[model samples]
Target: MKRQGGFTLIELVVVIVILGILAVTAAPRFLNLQDDARNSALDGLKGAIAGASGITYGKAAIDGVESLENQTISAGNETINIDFGYPADLAALEAVVDGLEADWSNAASGAAILFGYDGYNQRCVSYTPATGANVPAVTEVIEGCGTNF
Candidate 1:
C-alpha cells in the first residue's frame, strides 16, 4: 500500500474516458456551428443582394441606362462591375468583390455583392468558414438557398 509517484493505470483510464466523453459530446456541437454560421451568412448575403439590387436598379432607372449587363464603374483606383443577368452572375462582379473581408460568415459565401456606379457602390458581403462550411455547390438545396442572389 505504498503511494505512487505517478498516476495509476486506473486513474489514467478514467481521465481518458472522461476526455473521450467530452469530445464525443462536443464534436457534434462544434460541427453544428458551421451550419449556424452558414445560415447567418446566407441571411446577410440576401440582405446585401437586395440592397445592391435596389441601388443598381435605382441608378439604372434614374440614368436611363438600359441593359446594365457587363457595365464597369471606376471608383478611385478601383473598378466596380455590375451584372444584370437573368439570374445572378457572380463572375462578372468578382473583381470589385476584392473589397470583401474574407471572414464574412453572414451571407454571400465569403463574397460581396455590390450595387451602384462609381460613387454609388454599396456592398452586401457574406462570409464562409475557412474550413469550407460554405463551399459552393450545385445541389438543389444550394440553388434554393440562392434564389435571392
Candidate 2:
C-alpha cells in the first residue's frame, strides 16, 4: 500500500475551521474600519470643496469679481461669499456642501475639525481661501491608522 501525500477530508475541514476562527477573532484587529472611514470622508470633503471653489470662480468671472476680494456669488439658493475667485472662509465652503457640520468642526480660521482622533491632527482637513490667482487649497492630514474617528 502507498501512503498518500494529501490531507483527509476531516483534516481539511479542521484546518478550515481553525482558519475561520482565527479570521473572526483577528480580522477586526487588522482591518481598521474607523480610520478608513474618516480618511474617506475627509477625501470626499476635499473634493467637494475644490469643486465648489471652481464653480464659485466661474460665477465670479461671469460677474466680473474674480480678482476682487470679499465678493458674493450666487450658487443655487445660496449666496456664497468668496475671495479671489474661491471660498472666503469655512462658512463659504460649508454653504455649498451639506452635512459637513455634522461631523466636522472648525479647528481654526482656515482649518476644520478634531475628529476624535488618537493621533495628532491626523483626521482633519485644511481649507485655505484662494488668493492672487490661486485656487483654494484642500488637503488632508494623513499620519496613520488610529483607534477611532
Candidate 3:
C-alpha cells in the first residue's frame, strides 16, 4: 500500500491528544500569570496614591507650590489637574477611578498590576493583566488629607 501524504487517523488523534494535554498543563500557569499581573498593577496604584497624598498635603520633601487650583500630578506622561473643590473635580476622578478599579478587580484579579501617571500628559494608570490585557484604566484620585472639598 502507498503511504498517505497526510497524517493517518491514529496519528491525527495522537496529535490532538498531545495538544490537549499541553493546553491543560499550560492553562493553570497562564491563569496564575494573569493573577500576578493584576496584583502588581494594584500595588503600583497604591504606591502612586500614597505618593500623591504627600504631594497633595505638602508633606513631600520636594519643593513646589501646591495649590489645588493649579496643582497637577503626573504619572509618566499622564497628568491630572487637582481642583478638589470644583463641582466636577471629585465626581470626574471618582467616575474614572471607579470604572477602572472595577475593570481591574474583575478582569485582572491577581496579576502584578502597575499604575502610572502622565501616560500622555494625562493622569491615568495603565493596568496590564497577566494575559497581557493592557487596559490603560484610570485609578482612584489622589485624595489629599483633610480635603473637605
Candidate 4:
C-alpha cells in the first residue's frame, strides 16, 4: 500500500472553523479602534484647552486683572483676550496655542464654546470660560464621538 501525504479532510474543516471563531471574536475590537481614536483625540483637545485656560489665567493674574473681564494681554507675539482670567473665547485660546483649527471646529453657545471633532459639532468639548470665582469648565460629549451626526 502506498502512503499518502495529504492531511485528512477533517483537519481543514477544523482549521477553517478556528479561523472563523477568531475573526468573530477579534473583528469587533479592531472595528472599535476608530471610536477609540476619536475619543482620544477629543480627550487630548480637552487637555490642551484646559492647559491654555490655566496659562492664560496665570498671565491675567500676573497682570492684576484676573477678575476683570474683556481684558487683553500679550504673551510673545500672541495677544490673548481673557474674561475673568480665562481665555475669553476659542479665538483667545487658539492664540495661546495653535493647531486647534486644523482638525476641530467650534461654535459659541450661551456661556460655553462648543468644539466638535472633525465636522461633527455636536460631539465635542464644551469649554466654559472662567467666571472669576472658579476655573474654566471643560466637559465633553463623546457619546457620538465615532458616529455620524
TM-score of each: 0.37, 0.66, 0.35, 0.82
lDDT of 4 by residue, 33-139 (tens): 87678777878888888887788778888999888778999999888888888888778877875797776777677887777755553357778777765655454
Clashes of each: 7, 0, 32, 0
Candidate 2's TM-score reads 0.66
lDDT of 1 by residue, 1-149 (tens): 99769998999999999999999999998877755665565455555544444454454445553244545544356544543311124542333234323533223443433222122112223322112213321211132333132
**Candidate 2 lDDT by residue in tens digits, 63-111:** 9999888889888888888888877876777787676666565555324
Which order, best to worst by lDDT? 4, 2, 1, 3
Most TM-score-accurate candidate: 4
- Model 1 TM-score, all chains together: 0.37
By TM-score rank, best first, the candidates go: 4, 2, 1, 3
lDDT of each: 0.42, 0.68, 0.39, 0.75
Off by over 4 Å in 2: 1-30, 109-120, 135-149
Native-to-model Cα distance after best TM-score fit, residue 23 in candidate 3, in Å: 0.3
